[model samples]
Target: MAKILVVDDELGIRVSLWRALEFSGHKVTLAKDGEEGDRLFRENPTDLVITDLVMPKKEGLEFMSGLLVDFPDLKILVISGGGVKASSKDIELLLDTAQTRGAVKTFAKPFELHEILACVRDLLAADAD
Candidate 1:
C-alpha cells in the first residue's frame, strides 16, 4: 500500500477520496486547502499527492510547484472542476499548466474513480521501478 495525500476545498470530495483511497488499502491523509496540504506533506511525506486546482489558499499549481521544488521526485496528480466562472478552455489551460509545472497526471473533475485508482497504481508502480 502507498501513502497518499488528498487536498481539496470541498468537504465532500475530500471525504470521499479519503475513504476510497483508504478502502483501497493505501494510507490516506486529507487536507482542506493547499497551505494545509503543504504542511502535511512537510510533516509526513507521502508516496503520492492528489490535489484540486482551484482553492482558497495557495492554489494547486503553486502548491505543486513548491512540492516539486523541494521534492523533485514526488508524484502528484492534479484534479479540477475549474472555477465557478471559468470556461472549459480555461480549465484545460490550467490542467496543462499543472502538467508543465510537475504534476505527473491531471484529471478534470467528475473523472471516474476507477480511472484515478488505475493511474495511481501505475504511477506508484513506475515509482517503484
Candidate 2:
C-alpha cells in the first residue's frame, strides 16, 4: 500500500479524502493547512500528496514549490474550489498553473469523490511502475 497525505483547509474535504485513501488500501495522513502539510511532509515523506489550491496560511503553490525542492520526484494532485460563481476562464487558468507545478491531476470544487479517487489510483499505479 502507498502512503498518502491529504492537505486541505476544510475539515470535511480532509476527512473525505482520508476515507477514500483508506478505502483504496492506502495509508493516509491528514494536514489542515499548507504549513502543517509542509511540516508533516518534511518529517515523513509520503508516496503522494493531495492538496487544495486555495487555503489559509501557506497556499497550495507554496506547498508545491517546497515539496519539489525537498522531494523532486514527489507525486501530487491539486484540487481547487475557485468559486460558486467563478468564470470558467479563471478556473482553467488556476488548473493549468497547478499542472505546471508538479500536480499530475487537478480537480475543481464540487467534483465527484470517485473522480478524485480515480486520479489518485492512477497516479499511484503509475508511480509503482
Candidate 3:
C-alpha cells in the first residue's frame, strides 16, 4: 500500500476520503489547507497527494508547482468542487492548470470514491515499477 496525503478544507470530505483510503489499505494523512499539506509532505514525503483546488493559505496550483520543483516524480491528484459561484469553465481552467503544473489526474467534486482509489492504485503501481 502507498502512503497518501489528502488536502482539503472540508471536514466531511476529509473524513470520508480518510475512511475510504484507510479501508483500502493505504496509509493516509489529512491536511486542512495547502500550507499544512506542504508541511506534512515535506516532513513525511508520502507516495501520493490528493489535493483540493480552492483552499486558503496557498491554493492547489501553487502547492503543486512547489512540489513538482522539489520532487518532480511526485504523484498528485487535483480535485475541486470550485467556489459557490464558480462556473464549469472555471473549474476546467483550474484543473487544467493543475495538470500543466504536474497533477497526474483531476476530478471534480462528488467524484466516485472507487475512481479515486483506482487512480491511486495505478499511480502507486507505476511508481513501484
Name the best candidate (by lDDT): 1
Q: Give Cα distance to truth, residue 26, candidate 1, Å.
A: 0.4
Model 3, 10-87: lDDT tens digits are 999899999999999999999999999999999999999999989999888888889889999888998898867889
Taking all chains together, each candidate's TM-score versus the true structure is: 0.97, 0.93, 0.96
TM-score of 1: 0.97
**Shift of residue 67 alpha carbon in model 3, Å:** 1.1
Worst 10 residues of 1 by lDDT: 15-24
Task: lDDT for model 3, please.
Answer: 0.91
10 residues in a row with least lDDT, candidate 2 = 82-91
Collision pairs in model 3: none
lDDT of 1 by residue, 17-126 (tens): 88888998999999999999999999999999999999987899889999999999899999998989888899999999999898999999878888898999899989
Error of 1 at 94 (Å): 0.3
List, residue by residue over 1-129, the lDDT tens digit for candidate 2: 999999999899999888888998999999988999999988999999999878889989898888998788899898888645677787888889999977888988878999988888888778778
Q: Is candidate 1 or candidate 2 better by TM-score?
A: 1
The deviation in Å at residue 64 for candidate 2 is 0.7
Clashing residue pair totals per candidate (backbone < 3 A): 0, 0, 0
Task: In model 2, state the lDDT of residue 111.
Answer: 82
